[model samples]
Target chain A: MKMIIQPRDERTQPARIIAGYPQTPLRSPKEPLVKRAPTLSELSGPLEVAKRVKLLGGDIAGQGEKQAIGQLIHLRVRVLDEDGAPVGGAVVEMWQANAAGRYIHPNDDDHAPPDPNFYGAARVVTDESGVFELRTVKPGAYPVPTRDGWWRPPHVHFSVFGRVWLARLVTQMYFPGEPLNAQDRILNAVPDAAARDSLVARYIPPGVEPYNALVFEHQIVLRGRAATPAQP
Target chain B: MMIPTGEATIGPFFPPRYVDAGANDLTVFEGRKAKGEAIEIHGRVMQEDGTALENLIVEIWQADAGGIFRHPADPRHAQADPNFLGWGRAATDAQGNYRFKTIRPGAQEGRAPHINFMVMFSGLMRILKTTMFFEDGKDPVLMAVPAARRSLLIAKGNYEFNIRLRGENETPFFDD
Candidate 1:
């Protein structure tokens, strides 16, 4: 079979290029290989039923009937494909530390107390319009065991699965106006300031001010540049 | 249209709840066994320094024995196996070893049989995507790879492919 090799466009950077943390050392240099675009065969596959979607709720950190301790926030995300089309039925999974910067997992040895109410994870499927919403508390920043006492800025981790495996994406979402954004190595790894800014969620006002819950809007673009821009 | 968004790592804190009870087994779906030759793909996740990378998550998606995937986008005429989910996700053990129980995927679009893999771990700026081919298959994708590095993409009986994140034996990665 004959193969046509193409050069990678300079505009879109792969994740490995921008992942500049100590844990993830840079990859060794090698000849650039053509990334075969997804063929119809690759597109044909079963979309896993949204079994994890049952965990979706406004209170990720909170247990049944127990609200987590922290500032209340509402998060809304839209999933889109490379064509700038809404990708309905895609799964969006998110995990984050509690307001105190503590995770409920065993590996998280951080001294901060794990909020008993916070489950720390939620999974939901985008609706027909490609949107998923969750009500949760703002997470806190915590120190990591990297060199120089590296502290991870408050952020939410996201895993998105589109129609096929080729569209899978995993990234972190940051809050806008955080002072630590300037110093975070991971966020800074992306050379493009606009791309990095897309990771920050924008605050939106809720209709009822008395409710006092913070609202943030963010969107995830699945594939190529033709898809909706990462951040608008 | 906007530029494609950059990738990010799946940090160390992936919740345990993400793993479903039978996520590692693709053959067994709702008590009905998928039709095909059941095989196991096993390997370890290692860093460039040769240290074991435990707790990493690996997910695989492929076609069924009939060369049909369960996905809605597949335009092929092949019939998808009702009993096959065609997708599975597993995490590496303390020793960085991971395994998946699945059938040999059939060929599609004149291409050789292969399975797609996505690797995620803390510190990964984005998930790593790669494909695994059976040693016996005459896949052009495998043939196009350098002769010396082709072994890194092939799985023999019992199927083992140790992933080296970077370094001398850094596994070849693909663009989306």
Candidate 2:
């Protein structure tokens, strides 16, 4: 006996873009009309820390040797929703203190030597499964001004690109058991005790490489559906 | 309540349109898209009674570095930040809510007015982009509207202005 198969809809099928493989409903007038989610602001915590590098003052500079770390630091971040379903096409930007606790910026007055070889910034779009992997080095903790004193734990800042319909979240990732984490003013500012702890990265030593660095896994959620606009 | 009748001057910081057209390729030094931080600004736009109104389309535009416009009226300057496309389109939620993710424009000297936005909804047909001034702070004449908008902006590191949008509670408008 012969059997009849149904035709597949391309728009509903998983579409691949440079960012990631985005899966949406088959877009059609009759297809219950699931709206595409709004693009959210990017997560910019571990990324926007002011670095202290020589300002390239309107001059052409050659590419230097900052690639010495060889992308050894591994960042495996999973983008999820409140229900824990993987979110695809999430954009991630990561920049942190080099292994030596220094950044590349023009206004940095720290006078610490910068790795001429390192740009210390990288960007990647998440995969179809909402997973993004970045290979780099662990950044050392740097000090910033505080009322009582200067305090900062070794951590990475993360910024997320989210939808207008959803809430945008920006947070930092800290290694567990850092002494200064308790005293760092920024970390103490999160308001929720659980949310504060969620920002800390758990350690998984051994394997990966000979000089194994701590691995951090961060999960992000998209909140608040877009409300339908009212008629004037 | 005074309906804003004055002219509102906008910007010298408009973004110059990009010659390139890539969504993912964001290289700042090359005038490509840069990675912008993710943030959420959600709230309701209510009347004096806090009753929500809807059907408002919020539009935003800002200037890039060197205070230039996208596809500037004049040429001969550096390119605009591709990632910083100084324009956006948003409609209020069922509760008259609108949000956007624009960076705070930096300051420029001898500019027209403050960096204010053009908000349109209600009986307004066309998008009414307005230039708003702070209560009694800077000279609107010396500031750029894009920069002024950045003034009340909120972020992981800034102050946020919650607009009442109606009555005398609305922001000041400029003579454009």
DockQ winner among the candidates?
1
Docking quality class, candidate 2: incorrect
Per-prediction DockQ scores?
0.51, 0.03
lDDT of 2 by residue, A175-209 (tens): 78889889765455444566567666656575645
Q: Can you tell me which runs of candidate 1 are displaced by over 4 Å?
A: A1-20, A26-34, A51-58, A61-65, A147-149, A206-210, A224-232
- Per-residue lDDT tens digits of candidate 1, residues A1-232? 1111222334344335533366666432244543565554445434665641244654564545798999888888888765566778888889999999998898998679888888778888889888998888999998877647567888998888776566677888999988888888777777777787888898887785426678899988776332223365
lDDT of 2 at A162: 39
- Which candidate should be chosen as best, given TM-score against the real structure? 1
Per-chain TM-score of chain A in candidate 2 equals 0.62
lDDT of 1 by residue, B1-176 (tens): 54445667777888987777678888888779999989998998887778887888988888888778776556553478888888888899999999999998888766788888878887676677778888645565666666777788877667787777777677877654
Compute the TM-score of each model's chain A versus the native chain A and list the values: 0.81, 0.62
Off by over 4 Å in 2: A1-66, A69-72, A146-148, A208-214, A225-232, B1-176
Estimate, for each residue in B10-31, the C-alpha lDDT of model 2 and write its tens digit: 1111111101122211123234
